[model samples]
Target: MVKKYTVAIVASAMLLLTGCSQKSDVDASAQKGAESADSKLNQLGAGDGMMKLSDEEMKAQLIKDLEGKVESVYFAFDKYNITDESNSKISANSKLLGEGKAGELKIRIEGNCDEWGTDEYNYALGLKRAKASQDAMIASGTSADRISIVSYGESNPVCTEHNKECWAKNRRADFKLLP
Candidate 1:
């Protein structure tokens, strides 16, 4: 009986040690996995060497990197059709917005007009212009769900001077990025 009791105690201790060692092994593997993920994020520009950014932070960084890179699609004074020159701009913008970090963002297409017509007429024209640009972007492979249109009419002109150049600048569709 005494021998049996001693053997039982020894077996219990061995089982306990085995369980503890398995737990430690699991912990080690989990740590390794976390480190691997962090390294991958760093490689993708989503993290510093030591830490990962939150989703909002990464989006803000992407927006900052992409600012001013997208060119506006300019329009003729009374037309909403996409011109050849405007088509090139739209193609470039679409390519830029369809790849890498920019692909994950939403695009806001702001349509503007010069001070040449009534407020209602300008607003309608601006909306039509915005729709034309949006269609162009979609045709160039950007997702329709990711693009939104807004008409600013004559209220958001980049240049307010009374010249043809200034008016031309105002008659454009601007691109804005959102998280």
Candidate 2:
């Protein structure tokens, strides 16, 4: 009876201690979980720290980024063929896109015409100019998803003067990157 009593007393004490320790441990674990949730909430992107990108800023940066990275593509007086220099620029853009320099890139092709051709004809030519660049990009390996085409068709002029220098600037394709 003495031995049985001792064993029962020891077991009862151990059980009591275990139950007490478990409660404290559970409380500590709950505190840790709360801290972790707060940290996560403070994180940016996944939390209130997320930033909103302005469209104007995005457009300006993309245009500037593309400045020398892709050379200006020139169109003929009335024809649209992959000009040697323009083709080279398109090839570079395609290579960059293929190599992952760009992610989900969106390019806008803006075409313009000189004052010579009729608005209707020049508009078609301007579209052809944009399409020419599009073809080059596609051929070089840029997915259509990364590109868009628009034709300003003499409506939007880089230079207002009526001269070859101004005409050259006006008769061109402009590439703008969209976010």
Candidate 3:
């Protein structure tokens, strides 16, 4: 009777310990996934010595980074005033461009428009958008010589869903740096 009782107690303890270990392992995995998600939303996922990307690497990464960093202020049919919301995004990109104490890079601002406007009008509007971006870059300490502007009008759109919503997306500027 004593031996049987002892054996039963030992088995229950082992089972409990195993279950607790599995629970802790699951908790650790959940924590890791949450950290990954936070990195994605806030900034580029980087770690250790690899976090500091080189100037060449930075230049290569600018186009994609700027796409997410820069916000386009929508105009009412035909206008060029920076909105309050857009100002914030511009400010962030400005800091990123100005603060990096590294090699100077060349950037091209490509302006675009939706298909609703006339080709010529859209070309000019696109130019206005490019000019706006170029001016902002200059204000951010990027040299004028390093920045150039081009207008794509309605010819090239990052999105082509072909509606008011899709057209709005095309009516913006793209910032690309030479890598």
- Candidate topping TM-score: 1
C-alpha lDDT values of all predictions: 0.90, 0.78, 0.71
Question: Could you list the CA RMSD of all candidates, in the order they appear?
Answer: 14.7, 11.1, 14.1
Error of 2 at 81 (Å): 1.2
Error of 3 at 125 (Å): 1.1
Worst-scoring 10-residue span by lDDT in model 1: 32-41
lDDT of 3 by residue, 101-141 (tens): 32255667788888887669889998898888778667656
Worst 10 residues of 3 by lDDT: 97-106
Summarize candidate 2's per-residue lDDT along 74-164 as a digit string, tens digits.
Answer: 8768878877888888888777655543455677888788888666888889998999999888888888877889887889887889888
Assess candidate 1 and give its lDDT. 0.90
Model 1: per-residue lDDT, tens digit, 1-179?
99999999999999999999999999998886463546655667534645778889989988877767998888898889999889899999999998987998999999999989867989989999999999999999999999999999999989989999999999999899999
The 10-residue segment with the lowest total lDDT in model 2: 96-105
Best by lDDT: 1
Q: Please tell me which model should have the higher lDDT, number 1 or number 3.
A: 1
Predicted structure 2: clash tally: 0
Model 2 stretches astray by more than 4 angstroms: 1-64, 97-101
lDDT of 2: 0.78
